[model samples]
Target chain A: MNHLASQLVLVPVILPLLGAGLCLAFGRSARAQRIISIVTLSIVVVAAGALLWRADQFGPQAVNVGGWPAELGISLVADRLSALLLVVSTVVTLSVLLYSFGQGIVEFGRDTPLSVFHPTFLVLSAGVSAAFLSADLFNLFVGFEILLAASYVLITLGGTEARVRAGTIYVIVSLISSVLFLISIAAVYAATGTVNLAALPERIAALPEPLQLVLQLMLLLTFSIKAAVFPLSAWLPDSYPTAPAPVTAVFAGLLTKVGIYAIIRVQTTVFPDQPLRTLLLCAAILTMVVGILGAVAQSDIKRLLSFTLVSHIGYMLFGIALATEAGYAGAIFYVVHHITVQTALFLVAGLIEYRTGTTQLDRLGGLARAAPVLAVLFFVPAMNLAGIPPFSGFLGKLALIQAGTESGDWLAYSGVGAGLAVSLLTLYAVAKAWNRAFWQPRDEHVDDDVPSTGALHPGQNTVTEDKVLRLPRGMALPTLALVAFSVALTVAAGPLIGVSQRAADELVERTPYIDAVLGDVP
Target chain B: MSVDLALIIAIGVLVACGTTLVLERSLTRILVGFVLLGNGVNLFFIVASGPPGAAPIVGASDERMADPLPQAMALTAIVITLGVTAFGLALAYRTWQLEGHDDVQDDVEDALVIRRAERDDTSASFDEVDESLPEEEGADLPAVDDEVTRENDEDHESPDDGDPR
Candidate 1:
């Protein structure tokens, strides 16, 4: 059973890649591509669930590729955290793939060219899985590059003028971050003999204090850009809103969290003794305050959601900064909650865009009356995003706040304060969007001017001419499923929190993971 | 391990030039910068591999063999950079085809924010000012909106019409 669990670590990373190749082979038939992707991801979802159960039942599971020694060859490790996140992320990706199929089928018909989207999407899933499971820094870099390369193609899939422009910024920024990551990896390798995560702790501990700090900061800089933390997050809102809704939704759901996941792994395991708490707390506070402020200013629902996505990253960073078991638990829980809720919200926004011609607040109205189900869809996630009670978002925020207050530090107290304020501001922003886009009467002037809406450059006006008044059942079902899944997070918060606590304990102790990777070495 | 001054100097020079070019507006220049930056980082990996030695083949030489790991990683980095270069060139060419230039444009939303800031209008919402303000004061707001709309229209359309280059 133990050996079987260990071998299962490779499934999440390998299956999707194999699926991608098959998808490319069957590129002519969109239906074939769809079936292959759905079957591939559904199988992954089940495997991830089994992996999580096994990880919880056993300890961390590790597999060395090519049967090489742990330190010499690449290793993939799945402990409680990676397995749990893998389950949630795979579920989210599967749903988003379904949602994209809905969008593609409805807009472009079932026979639309199946060449790039499915294969690239599968490659992205593979990349994300590899990043989560990788036991070494270099493999993590490769994982990032794979996912990013896939994202670059996905973002510019249509090659629209706006998409091209947005994709340029996205690609350039990602390239710079990748370069920085490589430089840091080089520095780490130069300082320590091995890039293996299991071996690095001892060597990194022996480095001079200042040198350790430099290495830590270099990595933090690279990850901060990827995570879309403040001062480095300007590119997110500018680029994300221009892509197709499903692409934006998946990117919002998975990509930045992968960066945060890396930060958590590195901070807790690699540089455990580094006293960079204050710097991280400051970044958290700023990311929260500034991100929400930006969200409040946006008139476009997608961009507004993008800003909130940035804002909520602050919450996870806050949990990590607290550096307590409760804090880690809170951060992990928040990551799960945010991934579901944010993706659901974006999918809802896509549904809204599909029904109406635009997502602009000024131009949108009467949605509640016109489409009650859409209203319900949008309302549930919006409230969840704002941390309303009886939702996972609220539970996750409560956990973070509880962790912060337990620390009893002034910095944490301020973080708690900023967190509460940001929550309120998030509510304000989404509520404003709701009131304008749904509750109010459709402005007659804007309704009459729908033909000219495409000429209006700033707004994401995808279907300006032929407005699809009815929501596609394919799209709505997956979105509803995601929203329901997020609600389930609240209902299952007890077991989820317990799992995260155990994961946090393992992270704090660090031996379980190190042993899982290197214990059998001769 | 003996350090190579020339290799260090080359890494520094390449990275410096890459950073400078990356800050430029032109997409082609940025793509070039990205390639240079990637090469410089790859060179750093070579340095990290330690002093040069015979190829890392088993029993190839009696002397210390070069570390094979960093070379493998450097090769990976080179492959990734090559993929990125191809994508970046394609993107730049697409931009040229569309806009008649390869320069990145300012984000329209950001430019609007700057315009609002310059006018001392720190209102949270852009389109809501008319409803909040009195008739005469509100009258001036639509003109600002029109000005922005015109600017955006010209921004998208002017390049094709004029073909300045």
Candidate 2:
């Protein structure tokens, strides 16, 4: 049973790798690929759940692969932080997969190549899991590359001019950032003599001040790019919308968190110092402001959602920057909430695209009257994202704010206040989406009674497009699952926060993580 | 550090090549730019760890003649770059197939929807803004095909019946 606990940490990563191989090896049949992919993901979700339970009981634990000692082998760890993330990722991946079932990104003249999508998505999921589990900087880099490599395929899956263009930029930025990460790791090893994250504190503490700052700054830049932080986020909006719905949903929910997770790991465990914390706070504020501003400016739902993803990252940064037990806990809880809510909203947007054949707000109207259930699904997450009371998003935001205030950091407090304000702004943007796409009156001229009218299906009255806007069940089920889980998050916020708080304490104390690396942290 | 010097030259070459690609109008060249940029950064990683040979892997000889950490990092970076380059090339090929050109500058304002939003600025301006899409960018996009089908259902069904392909 104790050994099973270690295996739990590897499941999310392993399942995806197996799924990718199954998809690639059995590449001839799309149906086989889809089934294999879904089954693997289901297993990962179960594993994530079990790991969460184990972490709940035993606290932060590390597993060395092949039974090698931690120092000599690759390691996968599940602390409160990683476990929470694992659960969130599992939920999001499941939703996106569900939404993509039966209705695989169908276009006019061409069919979406399912063979590529299934395998790449599996690789991506693997990468995301690897990022969460890694206890070493270099392995973390491999995870980033794996995640990025999978994304490049997913983003470029359509092989369209725009997707390609966007993918080009995405790859370039990723390349530059990754290189920077490599450089930072190298310097750290040269100065500190170890890249094992657990060993980093002692090694880093021994280094001279200026050198440490340089290495830390390098890592900061590297992760900022991955998280789509203010200056480094130019590639995101242009690229994300062009992929299939499932890909977008996963990217929205899972991808950026990996970057945020890396920042938390490095800053807290490796570089537990003051200067870095202050810098993170500054970056958080800027990311929030810039992201919301971008969201406010866009009328396209997908693009708007992308910007909101950026703004929400700021909230995570806030908790990480405070570097307090409470702050870290709040950040961890917020990550779980944000992933579920964000992915749900993106999937809902895909539903809208399925109906009206477009995501532009102008072309969409009176959909709430049409697609009430979808509206319900979308409304829950959108309102949650805006941080209205009772939803996980609000709880997460409140936790972060309370932690900031308690920490007696005026700058951080103001940033939290700004974050709250952005939550409202986020709400406003979400409301704008609701109003334009679901509440606005329909145009009479375009209602030429096209062949798409009449006869409600078992679950749809959403639109009057293409003979009933028939959304495959697979598409809606995954999204609904995510929404339900988000609702569960809201309901269970008390306990989840409690556990996260404990995890947060562990992070702040740094004894366990540091002891794991620096050998019992005498 | 001999490794540091090697890192500088390799990344320098990458940076220069990337800048040149960014300047080119041809999408293929621009893609090449991205590839160069990625490789250059890989060089930065190689340089960062005391040249490329410092093996940081545990127990691979305690003397630390080479760093496995950077090498491992570079392997990931290289694989990721390969994925990106593959996508970029496919996109470039698709663009050439569509507009009959490989240059990005020529396609800047090609989408009818966004152009109408920008130029008309009237009763339809809001409409254009409502759905601000440029043309579909790649050969494999569902939206492009969906939009084409929708437009065809409304107006002409197969505009590309006489397509060069």
The top-ranked prediction according to DockQ is 1
The superposed Cα distance between candidate 1 and the true structure at residue A195, in angstroms, equals 0.5
> What fraction of correct interface contacts does each candidate retain?
0.49, 0.22
Q: Under the 3 Å rule for N, CA and C atoms, how many clashes does model 1 have?
A: 0
lDDT at residue B144 of model 2 (Cα atoms): 43
Best by lDDT: 1
Can you write out model 2's per-residue Cα lDDT over A132-243, one digit (the tens) per residue? 9899988898898889888877877667655665665665567667757766776676676567888777777787889888888888889989988777876777678767
Candidate 1 is scored at a TM of 0.92
Would you list the C-alpha lDDT of every candidate in the order shown?
0.88, 0.76
What is the per-residue lDDT of model 2 for residues B18-121, given as tens digits with 9 covering 90 to 100? 86886677878877787787777676666655643435656776574765655666677677667667766776677688669876532121133244446643
TM-score of each: 0.92, 0.83
Clashing pairs in 1: none
